[model samples]
Target: MKVHFILHSFNASCMDHNTLKFCVFLILVGLLVNISFAKNDFENCKRVVKVWADSSLDKEIGEDNHKLRDLLFFLHIPRTGGRTYFQCFLKKLYPGYLECPRSYDKLRFDPRKKKCRLLVTHDDYSMISKLPRQRTSVVTILRDPIDRVFSTYEFSIEVAARFLVHPNLTSVTQMTKRLRSKTKGISTLDIWPWKYLVPWMREDLFARRDARYSRGLNTTESNDSYDMEDFAMPLKEYINHPASGDIVHNGATFQVAGLTNNSYIAEAHEVRHCVQKYKILGKFVLQVAKKRLDDMLYVGLTEDHRESATMFANVVGAQVISQLNAANSSLDIGDKIEQRSFPDSDPHSSEHQNSTSDRGASKVTSSESGETAELNITVGELMNSYEGCISNLRTSYSGRRIASLKRISPVNFSREARLQVSEEVLQEIRSLNDLDIELYEYARAIFYRQHKTTLQTFTEERWNNIPSIVYGITLWKVLPLAITCVFLLFLFLVIVNVRRRTLKIKMKVMKS
Candidate 1:
């Protein structure tokens, strides 16, 4: 009522007020709106003080304390230190046989058939529907959306540039069927949404660099030899491009809510389907995202690698790692650790297996500065380039190891440098990722609140001795002797007590 009255009064006063008075009135209205939004923002996310208060326990395979049996789903947002978390921590904490095959290009995960305990994937929140009815807890890591966007742009450019330089950039085909394959191989450049954005970036960047050369920037440089990292388009151009809609705009919110502008999933249309999937979450996206965040067991931040890792070890690790001892007792856990550090690994894959069928089928023709050239992309070249892109991505990304997260390190392994953007571009990025910004802030606050009362951070001693202390593992050679000695000592003490009791009874009888 108060706001209504104030607004009505402003409406009336606006007709008679001078310019100065009108400006003051507008300022007052702005303050009112800001205050209301501030309150709503606070109300959206509950201030969580306890971390494990909501962690549910379950009985699975005769194990009552196995809370992780309730589906340890890791909602891995791209470029969010996810590789480090999975490679360094999750693999160490759980056996490989327990991890679900990754569902990247495809979205089919059946826990009932697979009987997998851990789920780590890049699928969106829509994955909840595809999953069968079961108890699951979602955990994820968030980044400052601005930094995430820049990293994404940087990584895309890096991948595209490599594709441009590769010998198989245009000439490779006859790819074998990999239906059940976990390697998410992208076979074409005309895929929906943001997949094509990579090729678009490639073309734009080539044009951008060629223009520089024409202006006599580096005429002395070789025609064929060049740095692979030099073709990244300018920050403003990359973010503002028409192709960046789905991939760049409020990605965190979209991933969290699993929302698409459809009454149903994958609805087809003549024209709408052809248009790229628009990814900026609409009104109430944050509300849905915040509720989803609140429902999660934990939401980690990319920036707070140490604190996040420690909190996860203390909170989530106790649920899963506490049960690994029985599985790895005779087996060396160090040997059971992650053998495959990266996701794009497949030994059975062959490059030249079907080259005869696709010798000159799929080729890309690109022209720059009125010079034309046709480059063929065979299946071998495409797979090889994709694999190299993965390698380059690995070089660019570095996450803290679980064992080393507790300690500080001086060496920096990340090839991705801190990017600088113009003020206008920064503001534009902020505008585009506003929802993610708010969501990240709420997650950060909850993280601190959850850890505010905990005293000890996860230590290396605990990491090394997890099986022994938590999983009840004993030394293989000494366990039997220790058990026998305990039994013998108990037997001897029982005999001595019985003898003393008999002696007491006889003495009492003689005295009587």
Candidate 2:
């Protein structure tokens, strides 16, 4: 019909008023078409691009359902209680050979290079492409964005203060080696972010040093705790520093989306340019990061330590239950759930020693063999296992461990750091990290859903997976309908004008 209208209009007199009106009408229609095409396909997709994972297709559990995935990837975002979580949970689950080496500065953690069952790193989501696509489950924990910013800044200063104290250590490698040698093995310093982050921070922040900052260090206070107050940085000055930009910006969003500093998907920036910059970037990042978070089997939270630990046990660690069942045929579903932990005779050792041994055909072993035996907690035995190495995460991570560490760690000073920031500055931090804030909210939603419905049978999980209120419409879908409406309106106007012209021409001929 559009073709017929165009042909009919063109077939009219070249010099006629009807022809001129038709030309103007065509120009207007073309402009509308151009405007529609000029906008990004993602702009309309903004809120409308729904993020839901479906698995209802396979109703029954297959034979392979009991087997573990190829890899368990811990997408560790810094300053999110990741260290404590890794120590308490993940480090216990996979024995040393099965676990990837601790990687902070190194980004390339392909299992092929160094074979391991689990990969834990501070690298962003972009590392997903280099990994084996099949059956690689990812997990991460999130912190409140404002608190995370504060923690990051304070931690950087703490690390820098330590670096300044040891003036002989010129590089992270030297420092890592020194700590490793002093501790006689893999120490906290060996794997911590200070390995790569501290040297640069010392160079950047500590241009001029004062003795008062480190003077009180190593002194036993009234309670016998190390004085860490002198290490704190002013929040406002830290926020303004160029070095702090990556730490304070929408860090969680960028890290989760693989759009962090010096590296980003060009498409995301392009989409931002074509739409409302802040709004569109936040939505684009939230959608992508939310999808990644959904892909993970479990997500922990810094604040909700106990709940996160419980969820991690049920969701990500369920395979351990299956492995235990396979290892011992006499074991019932409700039997004791204990697996082997490596290199730690004492389950709750702070040293948490690792092995450099070859991969074991079997993951769990008997305590008689000298390996650290972890009581694998079955669903029925979860409450009791809360006292063990990993499950102790429920207890230790909740309040006990952090509180104990506060006596010596910088956490004791974090309250003072937070108190220094005014309400306005805190709000400014929120504004800067709006995407991370949104991402964290979505993380909370995923966390809730994992606990609520993820444990159900596959069909039920799929059936309930669709969020009733979250069906997003892509602007891509809206554009076609908009174009159709514009075309119909233009057609109506053209027809009305053509009819008026026909009547006027007939009347003139009749008078002649």
Candidate 3:
């Protein structure tokens, strides 16, 4: 009986041990299953983490090994933030690889030497024809024509003000009289005075041109002797003058079409084709202008400068840098004048001299301060004029659909002094610059398309990398907890199995 009982107990003990072993094995299997699931989750996470490998920019980077051999020809339009672009971005990006020759004499190109990668110039579209078309990538920035004209006018005014200052000339009236007196040979009384004026002039009766006016004026000589003060009439007189067209004419088209000479005016009377006769060769000119614009790789807008810079950088395969630094570094006329006029002062001063200097310093300081104040006021007026001109352009294009356009305050005049432009003047400006307006609109459309494509590409690239970014973040947060839970569960299963084995052995001993 005792043996049977012991045998029965041992059987029970063995069964219990076997059952505990099975349970432990099952637990281990469960742990393994958990581990497998976690591993699968981690692997799924890895799939997302690897998304950056599919970036379009990555492809671009890979392809960057192939260096571009084409010369970047920048058509630097005046008053179009070209200085900032050239000095700040291009110079830094290309470093010692930029050539900016202001005159035709310095525009020599040597294929073998290839001294410059970038050729920036104020030279017109005609200049591009002179270069190897296959090897040149032409880029240019365009501004609102009216705004550009205003900026040019203001710049001329500022330059003239700095150099043509007279002690007796307290107001603009006195200054105008002085300028007229000095410029005796330069008459402002002609029916079409623009022909006799400098080619760059954009204001007053001087804005109109006649073929006869170009007969004696040499392009080179006129440009060389061009004086801003010579054309500095009172702003009121300029606006009221019948010859001062309602709006500044197609300065951009003229320059871009390579009509820098007076030939455009001279040939105005000769209609080469009957189709072009209605507007006196206007349609032909427009077609030619469009063709020239089409030849450019990119046409930028000053109004959308930031996007323009990005586009420029992308085309050149350069890392985008802020153009603001370069823009800020550009010296204004005021800064230039200040630098030239204010040389470093002497360090030495005698005690007696100092006493006298102190006595006179207040009077000198007051007088100088008053003069500075007046000059600043004039500059402010010029800036106001610039703003007013821009406003006028905006209003003209706003599609208000009114019979008569409301007149804005006159430029280069005080707020109290109001000037109104006739509808005839406004219509005339629109007619003259119709081609330029069309070109500007076309350029805007192109810019919008290019900008949209670039943005879409960038967005797609970012989305491509997002899965990897999320996976990495998930791994960082969830990995450690998963590992610890697995270890603790494994330890618990081992302990439970050992305890059951010991308890089964004790049961066997008690039975014996």
Q: Which candidate has the top score in lDDT? A: 2
Candidate 2 lDDT at 229 equals 32
1-512: candidate 3 lDDT, tens digit per residue: 43345445555755777676655555565566667765675554434322322221122222222123356777666667765555434443432212322221122333443333467655555565456655566677888764564454444333333322223224534665676566422221111112223222323213221222345421221221112122344433333333333223565664455443322323221221211223433444555556555556677899997677666655443321222223224746564344224321111221101011121111111133221111112222323333444455446424321211111101232112212434454454455556567777777887788778778977998899999887778676888988999999999999999999999999999999
Residue 185, model 2: Cα distance from true site in angstroms: 7.2
Query: The CA-based lDDT of model 2 is what?
Result: 0.56
Residue 286, model 3: Cα distance from true site in angstroms: 2.5
Better of 1 and 2 by TM-score: 2
Point out the worst 10-residue segment of candidate 2 by lDDT. Answer: 51-60
| RMSD after Cα superposition, model 3 | 38.3
Clash count, one per candidate: 10, 9, 4
Candidate 3 residues lying further than 4 Å off, grouped into runs, are 1-69, 100-113, 166-248, 262-280, 316-425, 465-512
Arranged by lDDT, best first = 2, 1, 3
**Model 3 TM-score on a 0 to 1 scale:** 0.44
lDDT of 1 at 335: 36
Q: What RMSD does each model have against the real structure?
A: 18.0, 28.9, 38.3
Predicted candidate 2 versus true structure: per-residue lDDT over 1-512, tens digit per residue = 44445545555633466577777776566556556654544545443322211211121123332235667777788888765555555554555535654332243463443345677777776666556646566778999998888777656555555455444435645866766566545433333344444455555434433443356454332321112233334466566565555444677777777655423344443433322343543565566677677666677788887778776666666675565344456543332223222232122112323332422222344444434344355543542343354444446434644453343344354365456546877787787778888888988887777666655654575577667423566779878999999999999999999999999999999999
lDDT of each: 0.52, 0.56, 0.45
Off by over 4 Å in 1: 1-69, 104-107, 110-112, 167-169, 172-196, 209-230, 260-283, 323-420, 453-512
List, residue by residue over 422-447, the lDDT tens digit for candidate 1. Answer: 56777988887777899889888877
